[model samples]
Target: MKNFLLLIVLSLYLHSSFAQNLLQPELEAFYNPALRPFYFGVASGDPQPHSVVIWTKIVPENLGLQQIHWEVATDTLLQNVVQSGTGEADSSSAFTLKLVVENLEAGTHYFYRFQHEGRYSPIGRTKTAPEGEVPLLRFAVVSCANFPSGYFNAFGDLARRNDIDAVLHLGDYIYEYGSGGPRKKKKNFSRPHIPNHEILTLQDYRTRYGQYRLDPQLMEAHRLLPFIVIWDDHELANNSNVSGAQNHDPNSEGSWEQRKAIARQVYFEWLPVHDNPQRSIIRSFRYGGLAELWMLDGRLEGRSPQAKGTGDPALPSASRHMLGEKQTEWLLDGMKNSTARWKIMGNQVIFSPLNDSKVFSRDPSIRMDRWDGYPAERSEIFDFFYKNNLRNIIVVTGDVHTSWAFELTGDPLNPSKYNRKTGMGVTGAEFVTPSVSSFNFDEVVPKFVTWEAKRRFCKKKNNPHLRFLDLNHHGYMTLTLTPERAQADWFFVKTLYEVDYRFKQKGGRYIEYDGNQVKKNKKR
Candidate 1:
C-alpha cells in the first residue's frame, strides 16, 4: 500500500504540469493509487459467437504512447490461454483501449485481462453467444444511473450475483448533470459530479465517464460480466432528438452539432462496444434458436423532435419517426426474418402506449418523450405485428425511472382491439426496469402522493393492458429466457443512501412462447 501511494505521488508530480497545461485538472482526480495505471478497472461487451470486445484505459505517468497487452483464457488463472495480443494506446482516445478478440468457442465462459509494463489489470469475465438451441439465458436489465443522486447499491447488488449472463444497459449510464444541477441536493450523499458542470466538451464527457468508471460497484460489475448497452437521452442530453435536446441552449452552449459529436466520440471511446462505420448502434445478437436480442438506437439516428404539447397536430403524423426510416426498416425486417423463438428488444423508452391522464389529472399529454409521442409509428408497428402473426415478442426497456409491465396492443381501452381479461389482442409484452438511482415519483412528490394509493389507482380499469407497476424503488430486473417462456423478475434494494447490498424480489411478469400475453408471477 505504501509503495502504491508513492507511485501515485510520483505520477502526480511527473504529470501535474502536463495536466495543468492541458487545462484538465479534474481528470487528475480519477487517478487512484491502489488501481495505479489501470485505475478505471476493465470491461467487456457486445459478445458474439466467436468474438467479444475487451476494454481498458491506462493512466500513464508520462505523456507517451502505451503498449497494452491482453489475453483470454477459459479459466481465471489464465493457464490455458486461447488468444493473446498487444495494442497501442495513446491520448487521442483518452488512453482507452478497446480490442475485439476474435476466433473463440461459442457458448463458453472466457476470462480476460490487460497488462502494461509487467503490471496487470483485474481479470474480466465474458461469454460468447451460442450457436443452436440454447435452453436458458439470463440478463440483468438496468438503466438511469445518476451519479449524484445516490449510491449505486443496485449495481453493487447485481455485481455480487453470478447467475446472469450479461448486463443489458438501456442508456442514461452517465447523467450529464453537474453537482448543482436539477438533481436532488442531499447532504448525506457523498458522491458528486467531478467537473461541477454540465458536460459539453470532449474533456468534460471523458472526465464524467472516468468518474463513473471509478465507482467500485460499477467497475466490479463490468469486471464480472459483459454488458450489452444502448444510449438514450442523458448520454447526449435530456430528451435528445436528432436536431436538438431539451437540455441544450443554442446561444449559451455553442453549436449542438459539435456537442453531440463530442458526446458520441467520448461514448464510443469509453465503452467496449464496436463502432459502426455509419455510426449506427442498431445491432442484433442471436442467442441460438432460443432468443435474439435487438438493441435499438433511439437517440442519435434520425429521431424526430417531441410533439409540442398535448394538442400538437404532429403527434399523430405518420412521417414523424422514432427509430427513423432506415432503422425501422431494419428492425421490422429483422424481426420478421428472425428464427429465434423469443424476439427480445433492448429498448430505450416506453414502447407501449401509456396514458396516466384519467388516473392523475395533473399529468397530461401522455408523456411525449416516450412512444406515446409517436402514435402513428407505434400503431404501424402494432399493425405489422398483428398482420404478420408475430408471437412471443418481449421488450426490455429503461429510461422512465419506474418499473412497469405492459401487454402491448394497438388500443388497450377498446375491448375489440384488446381484451384485458384474456389478453387476446396483445401483440407483445414489455418489461420496464426502474433506474439504478434516479428520482422516481415517490422521491419527486413524497409529501403528497403515496405509493400504495398510486399503485391502487394504476389498475386494469384505467390502463387495461397494464400488468404491474412499481412507482417507488431503485433496482434492476433480471430477465430469463427459455424455450417455453421469458420471465422478468424485479428486484429492489432497501436503500440507495448508503452502501446496502440487501435486496428483495418484489414482483415479476412472464410471457409464454405460445402467445404475447403477460402473466403475473407470485413473489419468490
Candidate 2:
C-alpha cells in the first residue's frame, strides 16, 4: 500500500517537470545578447484607463522574423512585473513592434521595455487615464517638426518636464521634403533627409520616418511621455486633401491614391498609435471628468480641394468641407453627449479666420488650407454648439508655425455681430501652438527696420478676435485643464540652433467659462 502511494506521487512530479521543460528551449534561445536589436529605443501612446500601447523597432542585422519579448512593471526598477508577452518583429512592419498591455490600474504610471535576444531596450514611462474624477490634466502641445529646419530643442525641453501628463502632437510629424529648399540659410542645420529628395514612394516615406525617429531629442521625448498624435499636410504632401496635394503632382509623382496609401501605412507602422479600421486617425480620449479630447483628421480623411487664395467666391459654399459630413456629425454628437467639464478638440489647421486685409492694403485674402476655406462646415459645427448650449469648448490647433489665442466668434466676417455686452456670440476658444522648428512669419518676411513692429501691427489690426500672436518663437504650448478654467502657457526655446537651448515662458492665456458666457485672462 505504501509503494502504491509513492508511485502516484512520482507520477504527479514527473508530469509537472515535463510541463516546465517544454518552455525551456525557447526561453534559453531568447537570451542571446550578440544581436543589438533595440536601435531606435522605446515609446508608448494611446493610453486608456486600463491599457497602453508600448512600441519598439528592432533593426536586425539580417532580414527575417525575430521574436521579441516585452514586459510592463509597476515601478521603474521593473522588479514588480505586472504583465509580460512575446511578439514577432518581421520585415513586413519595418521591424516595428507594438504591444497593448491591458488590465492596469487607472491613473497609474508604469514602466515598460522590450527585449530582443539578451539585449534590453530603454525603459519608457507611461500613464493611464484617471477613472472617475480628475482634478487637473496637463498636456504639452507641439507640431510641424521639420527636421532639416533646425534642432529639436523644443522636444528636448518637453522631455525634461516632469509635470506634463502627455504630449499632444497636432500633426506634421515628419516632412516629405528634402534639405536646401527654403531652410538652406538655417545656421547649425546638419541632419539631411534619408532619400535626399522629395519623398513619394513607400520606401521613401518609411525612410524619412526612420531618420526623424533617430533624432536624439525626439527619441528622448518619446521615451519619456506618451504622445497623442494626428497627421497634417506634410506627412503626405504640402496642402494635401483627400484626393490630391499641391506638392504631389500626379503627372510626375505616380498615382495619388497609391502614394497616400503608402504614406498612411508607414505612418501607422512607425508610430505607437492604434490603427483605426477605417484608416482614419480620428479618435477621442477622455480624462475622467476633467476633459474629453476629440482628435480630428483635417488633412486626408475628407477635405475638399482648397480654393485659390480667398478670391474664389465659392469659399463659403456648403460643398467645401474640412471634416466631411460623417466626421462633422460624429464631432457634434460626441460634444453633445460628453459629460466632461471641458470639450477639447485636437484640430490640425487654424480654426479662427485670420484676414490680412484689415491690416494690409489688399483684398480680404485668406489661406484656403485652413478652416476659413470651409466656412459652411465651420458654421455648422458652431451652430450645433450654440443650439446645444454647450460651454467650455476649446480647440487646440497646429499646422501653422505661429502661436495664436483667439475667441472663436459666430461669424468671422462680422466679428462685431457677437453680443459684446454679454459675451454671447462666442462659440468657443482656440489656441494655436507654434511649430517645433518650422519657419514662421518672421523667417519668411524680409528683414528691415521696424520689422517686428510692422508685423505686430499687421497681426493685431487684421484679427480682432486674436488676443495674442507670436510669429517668431519656436516652441510648444502647455495646456492645463481644471473644472473651472483651461489655461494655455506658451514656452519658447532660447534658440533652435543650439542643442542645449533653454526653454523660457513666453506667455500664458486662460479662458474661464461660466454657463453660456466666456471670460479671457492673459499673462505676459
Model number with the top TM-score:
1
Span of ten consecutive residues with least summed lDDT in model 1 = 179-188
Score residue 10 of candidate 1 by CA lDDT: 85
Which TM-score value belongs to model 1?
Answer: 0.94
State every prediction's TM-score relative to the real structure. Answer: 0.94, 0.89
Candidate 1 per-residue lDDT over residues 13-63, each given as its tens digit: 868765544336776666677777898899999999999999999877678
Candidate 2, 315: how far from true, in Å?
1.7
Question: In model 1, which runs have C-alpha deviations exceeding 4 angstroms?
Answer: 1-23, 27-30, 180-185, 363-366, 452-457
TM-score of 2: 0.89
Local distance difference test scores for all models:
0.85, 0.80
Candidate 2 per-residue lDDT, tens place, 187-301, comes to 5557666668898876678777877777879988999899988999999999999989989999888899999998888889888888666667898998998889999999887
